[model samples]
Target: MGGFGPLETAGPVLVWTVVLTFVFLECALIIGLFLPGDSMLITAGVVLASQVSGEVHVWALSVGTMIAAIAGNQVGYVIGQRTGHHLVARKNGKYINTRNLTRVAELLHRHGFMAVLVARWIPWVRTLCPAVAGAAGMDHRKYTIASSIGAIIWAPVLLLIGYYAGSFLENVSWLMPAVIGTLIVGLVLGTIVGVRQYRAEMARPAEDFDLDEAEQEPVADSPWRRA
Candidate 1:
């Protein structure tokens, strides 16, 4: 708690709220494009490691963060399943662009479960992948299995890194600033890369959009499409 004096004294409830809300919303909604979930998780880990507050348990934080991430993705998937195509149809002034949705759909078709697993580490993709999987009519079982694996791997690894760093730097006041600075720089860079990828995806031609199997053959399978 050397240089993290104030953080050590900070209330656990506030910390929990900040961490959980950011992680949850970042996964559950398109707002994740702008939010820095990685940074938040790492910061939470550091704070907990610094023992800034005894009330914050590393296990609890890790588990809670994982749950929030998984739950958020589930919500996003459901939203995509229910209203994805409608949103695409009305994509005139919506935040969810049809082009990007189509691009995501294509990725899902190409990579299947792998897309969900890998996207968990890629900022904007992580938020959009689940929705795309749903909209593409990917098997729910496959999506859930892949998403759960990704969440389990992603949350704990970062949190542990921060926890270890915090423990190592607990006595070194000067090193804390360097760690904090590095995290800030990483967050900025990640956001820039994520935004660029998103823009690139949105710029893809409409012709490249992937239609569902039923959509590809509408009249022949109208009942199947509705089902």
Candidate 2:
């Protein structure tokens, strides 16, 4: 009852939609990086695998995910070129804060394309790398090429892992719940650790800013003051 309803239960079209959305969001932002995208892909593959009696093409979902991921990275790169620096300046901007941007900038300066490629798997860094690429003024052509290769490899590999796992776990229906449960647990743990680390990082002095508290002080009872 809590599963995908009719619109998303259709054949290739529905599966394609799911794959595309998952990849796009996963590559587009840090929040998506922690989503159960990997698990969902595997579940889709396993479910679709047995239904391959005729019209469905399992690889279609995999290919669709790759396309979405690559496109997302490109979008992120363009956004970074335009706003990576500004994001750090925005109030309450926790995701793309100054420290993260500085770290990404250093990586881009040092490693260039290799940095983007390697960051494809690291959840926090994945979303930031493409934007950092643009901020570093890397050649658009090179960025596109490197990002395309990385996305193609990263997206398919994750889906394939899920596909293979689904195949192996086919006869054991009981294991499905266990796998999903374990993934949820892992996600919770990762989130807790990530949040703690982020808080700790943010708690450190903003070395670059000596913001004047008097000029920007909020009124009494204001939300900003409360914060």
Candidate 3:
């Protein structure tokens, strides 16, 4: 049965470092949208379970990865809070465009907490959701709570699955390769779609996304006016 290649040869220290780093980066940075963080995690577990003396402590790995993921989400949230205003003010900035930002704002308004929690399973969205939540003025405390819960669930499930199921997977040599191939295809497609969306969004008028002003227009006269 094949394993994680050189990662299997590497000691537990290197394995832990690599897996944790990718997990954090995937949760914190936009570049993580393309990184194989999820796959790396499960593969780490699979390699450890292969009984080749990987010696990695499962508890440490799970807890550390969970903390890393939560920390990463916080970092992303802060980044969004810091830069979201600038992005909104500008029409066609370099990285994030206003059109997409508008859509995220609407989404957060609709499903702030649930979106954050569920985003953990959604790869690219997992990387972007924290930032969008912050940018949309979602409650910081609520975002933290939701993201923490998501981390608790997301960080361990796949890794544990791979660890426990490694024996069954060992007999199915084609599965790992197929999963890897599918992830590669997804990365390419996501990159392509993101680029195309950014370009199209940049072409739209920024003023159209002034959602705050539109909402502030008062649905009805104030109570004081009734007198």
Candidate 4:
């Protein structure tokens, strides 16, 4: 019932709103690093499976969330383009601090399109990769293709998992309690891990990003951006 609970009574519109909003925020422009993107997708499916007539069917949910995720990443890419590479220097943010940004940069540098495509499977990396790729001057077309593929793979799998599993577990007495308990445990563990990582990351001074290379060639001129 964290956010999706009360929506049961409110009907599918509000539920769609919540799901799509989070789908966008986590995968796209909002940089909601701490959001439970994976769990949410899975749970959304699972919940729909058990519901009598509420929430969108799994296929629709999958497609809608995929669109939201792709759109979100595209927006994030534009934000990165506008913000440029200096976004890596941003610090003191709750989650968008320098450390996380730098990590995204390194990952992008190491893998290029591969990173953007697969980042969908990783939580924090997925949140920041589009922006990082944009800031780093990855080609918009390639980023779009990669991000779209990522969204396609990411959304439906999780939603379907919850949907089909929920359908099967619908008759079980322990489903609700088990799910609630699992969510609670996951939340606590995620909090603890996030806090520890935050402290450690913040402890280090911000690293100087390579500004000279970026300034040497603008987006239009850079072959990397055209790739």
* Of 1 and 4, the candidate ranking higher by TM-score: 4
Query: Which number leads on TM-score?
Result: 4
| lDDT of every predicted structure (CA atoms) | 0.69, 0.59, 0.66, 0.69
Per-prediction TM-score? 0.73, 0.66, 0.68, 0.74
What is the C-alpha lDDT profile of model 3 across 167-225, one tens digit per residue? 56667777755554454456456556655665564565654334353122222221111
TM-score of 4: 0.74
* Clash numbers, per candidate: 1, 0, 0, 6
Model 1 misplaced regions, further than 4 Å: 1-3, 52-56, 89-96, 177-226
For residue 103, give model 4's deviation from the true position in Å. 3.1
What is the overall TM-score of model 2 with all chains considered together? 0.66
Q: Write the per-residue lDDT of candidate 2 for residues 93-147, one digit (tens) a residue.
A: 4654665666666665556667778888776677777766664455677778778
Two-way TM-score contest, 3 vs 4, winner:
4
Error of 4 at 38 (Å): 0.9
lDDT of 1 by residue, 4-50 (tens): 54554564565587778878887887767666788877876776765
TM-score order, best first, reads 4, 1, 3, 2
Worst 10 residues of 3 by lDDT: 218-227
